[model samples]
Target: MGGESRIHNFGAGPAVLPLEVVTEVAESLPNMNDSGFGLMEVSHRSPAFQEVIDSAMGRMRRLLSVPDDYEVLFLQGGASTQFYMTALNLLSNGGAADFLVTGIWAKKALAEANRIGDGAAAWDDSSNGFKSVPGDGDYSVRDDAEYLHYTSNNTLFGTQFNHLPDSNGKPRVVDASSDICGAHLDVSKHDLIYAGAQKNLGPSGVTVVILSPWAASRGKEGLPTMLDYQTHISKGSMFNTPNTYGIFVLDKVLSWVERNGGLDGAIRRNQKKSGLIYDMLDGSDFWRPHAEVGSRSMMNVTWRLADEGLEDVFLSEAMDSGMGGLKGHRSVGGIRASLYNGCPVESVEALASFMAEFESRHG
Candidate 1:
């Protein structure tokens, strides 16, 4: 399929998947493991489905190097559900939370927490035009706060926190939806890490939650059964009907990552791919990158043409040439090329070449 098409995907979330992984899923969905029925028709209590979930969790642990202390949960809904769940579980006894406001998603998370009666402080970084990370001075981390929340990578802004900030003694919680499996990290520092599987793991609908058992044990009561983390964890994520198809695809993608080089291998490839694009952006003044240099994201590379009018021209020609998804978020009007793990190095090269040709003609 890569050979037959000139198109390369660069959307922020619900982004690209390995073409090989997609083909494998397509072949397996109809009759997974040669079972009499399709995966969708398989019962959750059945041994076949148990094997599926077990294998999926095992692969996740191996790929991410998840510790025994952390429980890998395949939960319903995307990262958005995590906003309320995190607040409900962590602040159950009643305490404030702190969030470093970097982009739309962080703001949304804080807003959700506020609605749940958890007071949240948005760390001030507006002075830098939202292009840089927040300093210690920008926030007053409360000793009474249950946890400190932040998005590891801002997909919309093209900014990322390569290293999570040290919060003294507070537990760190991260919504790594855009850059989770694409890199390696010390998961011990975080109380909980949740990422939707759509971007690099698999298709949309299911979200992966990795939590310290202590964090999992504090889930609040009085919530609906479906929203309770304890309920899902106890049921082995098979309570009621599951998003079997999404889990199936996730299993395949995990296999792909394992074969290609686990977490370290993924980080190496991502760094290499984004480095090529960043080098091009830095060398030519014809294009100006939006995010602060040091904080720029390896997953989402956003930039703008020197002349604003060239934006439309670039988008039109790139799509015509079969290189698309380069248009940035409407809120930030520019171009964003999301280089998720599944996206090959060759795609990045195609995009760079397209940019050079377009600029040469228009410059």
Candidate 2:
């Protein structure tokens, strides 16, 4: 799949990775660091593997500018598991957490919290089909709430929070699974942030969690040894054998990000790539985007053609043109072009050219 014929991948998660990173991983697979053992075959506790995990976490801190008070954890179970873990750890004794339901993942996070204990939507936009973010007066925060939970980007709905919402001095927790390292964020403003590695980081088996010192202290006592964030933190994210190869790839990807000018460079490139598709959608009557103009996602550009039939034709033709993963999420049926940190300008331009030609032929 890393060969010259690789297609442009726009899948929402397990999305495209930097070609250079892929090549590096490919070369290391047969004999990593001249150890004569494939990365997958090595023991997680081995010194060589320990170096991989350590370098990965260190690079993550420097790239994201994580503070001294924060702890970075590499865990399994993806972002879904963190939904429950966040509530179990952060929601105070008999207190509720406020969730801002802007999209599918936020709703799922709220549901998971309710299943475990007390939680409520500070504001829910489900009634509006998640087409926009909340206006100034639309949502209110409770002073007594334990924390405010929100998803920074909605992969399915193709919407994103242009600005973090006000938590009214409460701890702000975010699920940034789809857009964590795609751009620079004010890490200090958030008490806890979690993201699955499949989208922008590395692969499916690893999840990255960044927790503030105060938040780490708030985890519920007597929890399972594995589910507890403190356990992983105290053990340096090796409480149990982690996804060694995934972390290895992640380290390489982070190194690529740093060498390519870090998060600032990623943001500029992402803006340019997504701009091509959004501009085409804006100028063409045949293609319509599902998201509101201001709330549109730079990571996943969701849009539709004139009708479902036309969308089918577009996807079929796009596949023939070497563009894959253009289908939309089931909940919101349309096209979603996920432009992650690794999606190159050339791929975006090719996709734009294809879109233009498709419109001219079928519009």
Candidate 3:
């Protein structure tokens, strides 16, 4: 779908992608790089796919400013797998890790860590209905913790850590699934960063994992081959038939980012797009944003109508107005507009106008 057929896509994941990137992928689908092998049917061991993976990795490293020593892998199974995989490799021998349970994903990350070792929450916002991310002073990491784990952005509640949480000098491991490339990130500060590519990078089934030297070399003595980072790293991210098409599309997307001014451009666009919606939310008491002012997410802007019963009406009107994916997550039960890297500023303006029109009619 292109041009008029495309509506404002704000679905959480398997989300919107750049039209340029999508067009390139679609063109490559039949015969990639003139290799005669379709993108989906190409062998992972082939030279064409090798070039694709290498380019994807190089672009990610440059875009994120990842340390030279850090290992970048394009793995399968999304960010959810890394929840247990991170713990399996980092905490397998038995050690404590502290977590900032900002939202559902962080809670799940910590719970998975506990199964492998001792994972405890240093601070959690669940009791507060996850309205904000905790300030460093609000939480205390364990003295003996191996590392500090946190989800950089809470997709469900639209809360994000504007500043890095104080890890108390421990290595930081983050699940940055929802807001990886679109948000401001210091890859060097964190020992490990794992993100599912669907949100901003490209499509689902491809995960970007960046690991520091320590994390790369910290594999346990007898980790299961598939779950172990070393296993994939040793084979150069080809432990199994990698996500061939996903990686190719990722490379194209990253190339698009490079042409569009890389990470800085993405950050600026995300801020601008989200700022428009936030301005509307803040100006009107008719709309109530879910996250605290200081902790709002630029990628996922979530909110409720002042009259809760109007939410369904709001979503319906949004769809009728040529907007799609305005529905909230089932659990969150409100509207969530995901302004990932791929989301355009024009879409936000359209939404803001729609909101104003709706409020004037319904308010």
Each prediction's whole-model lDDT (CA): 0.83, 0.89, 0.91
TM-score of each: 0.95, 0.98, 0.98
lDDT of candidate 1 over 308-363, digit per residue (tens)? 88899888898888777889998788899999988999889988998878878988
The CA lDDT at 64 in model 2 is 93
Error of 1 at 328 (Å): 0.6
Could you tell me the TM-score of candidate 2? 0.98
Candidate 3 positional error at 100, Å: 0.2
lDDT of 3 by residue, 228-343 (tens): 99998899999898888889988998899899978999999989999999999999799989999999999999999999999999999899888889888876788999999888
Instruction: lDDT for model 1, please.
Output: 0.83
Instruction: Supply candidate 3's per-residue lDDT for 79.
Output: 89
TM-score of 1: 0.95
Candidate 1 segments exceeding 4 Å error: 1-3, 135-138
Residue pairs that clash (backbone atoms under 3 angstroms), model 2: none
| Candidate 2 regions with alpha-carbon error over 4 angstroms | none
lDDT top scorer: 3
